[model samples]
Target: MAHIMITGGSSGIGLQIARLLVQRGERVSLLARDPAKLEAAKHALQSQYPDSRPVHIQAVDVTDGAALHAAVMDCVASQGAIDTLIASAGMIVPGSFLDQTAGDFNSQIDTNLIGVANAIRAVYPSMIAAGRGTITIISSGAALLGIPGYTAYCASKYGLRGLATALRLEAKPKGVSVCICFPPDTDTPQFRQEIAQRGPETKRFLGPPKPWPVETVAKHIVKGMDAGKGEIFFGFDMMMLDKLGPIIRPILEKAYERRNKKHIGAQEGR
Candidate 1:
């Protein structure tokens, strides 16, 4: 069984991905900031696989490079060299740029973009020395199209796309694979939190796009990693954004602006 380590495996998409991997009997290591959540995740997985599939967990903030590296080393000792690293740990705080604090903005960038980098860096040496491994970066739609009230979110995700592109070239020569998946808004705790913070302009601009269950997204992501895809995108909207976004983004933006005019007017009034 492949050893898959997910940076945000304690909750949301990360935990869901771990669940799927455990069900398939793959060994998993989960890293997150919350010890309680980590323990809960381990229990949930172990209970399901009472036959005792390996499910390891560590509590460490992804923003701390040294601590992250140490946790990776410890997991490597128990789980063997990581066969796959899913950099899925991420955070978001939705608000218009002017209204968002510098701390909030920087926090998202730290966890989403730099955190992903740290996770990859921690495992890359082992993978390169072993002459093989997969790294999957979990980006978002904001990576492709800027969403209203997600200035910071978009900045971080866009950086991930660039990182994935550049890293792909470097990894290919080392017999390692780097893949980035842009998932649409999925039903996750973080996304729900973001929804709660969005202004009406942001909400209206987003419209009523339905969220994919974490189960479906996790399944797709795992399959993509297995297939060694360079990039993975889901659903029709994402497909369009990936294949024809340059042609369509302007049109969509104009439409969104028109739809949310009233919301903007209200914000300006305030």
Candidate 2:
């Protein structure tokens, strides 16, 4: 049986991935903060697989390095080394440049960027020792296309993309594959909450409609992880943006200006 460790497996895309992996008979270990939610997710998985491989939960914040390392070590020891590690823990707190605080940006960088780094640091040595493993980092469409009001979210996700690129180069000789995923607007609670935060004018600034069910994105990610892909940009407009990166930037910038104009008008009316 393949042993897999997934951070943020308690909910959303991570939870979906965990459920699918467990259904496929993989030994799944969850690293998440909420014990109750984690237990609930585990129960849901167990309901589907009564004879499923072990589903262990390590309830701890991904931002906590020492604790994260301990949790990884414990999982690795128990599972006889993880065959795969998915750094899927992430969040979004959207705001325009003027409305956001230093804390807002820092918190995202700490969780979205440093969180991935910490998990990789904790998992890589064991994977290297085993001489085989795959690491999947969950980025976002914002990493490729800049959204009008989501400066911090885009920056942190871009950092994840960069980290994945570098790690790919580093792990090549060790037979370890690193995969970076760029998923579009997922129908997760976080996306719904961010859209709800939008003012009338800025709501349009969210850019394009959300598409693809959460399960579809999760399946695509699993396929990429299994194939040892360097990076997988999933979803509709996101793939186009990545393909058109050279010409897409200037076009997106102009579009964002128009979107900002609407926001400015809304603010003036207020």
Provide TM-scores for the models: 0.95, 0.92
Give per-residue CA lDDT, model 2, range 73-179, as digits (tens). 88877776888889999978778878889998788888899998999999899789888899999998889866756778889998998898888989989989899
For model 1, how does the per-residue alpha-carbon lDDT over 52-95 read when each residue is reduced to its tens digit? 57799889999999999999999989998899999999999888
- List lDDT for all candidates, in order: 0.91, 0.85
Local lDDT at 178 for model 2: 90
lDDT value, candidate 1, whole model: 0.91
Model 1 residue runs over 4 Å out of place are 262-270
**Model 1 quality (TM-score):** 0.95
Off by over 4 Å in 2: 199-202, 259-270
Return the clash pairs for model 2, or none: none
RMSD of 1: 1.9
Which candidate ranks first by TM-score, i.e. highest? 1
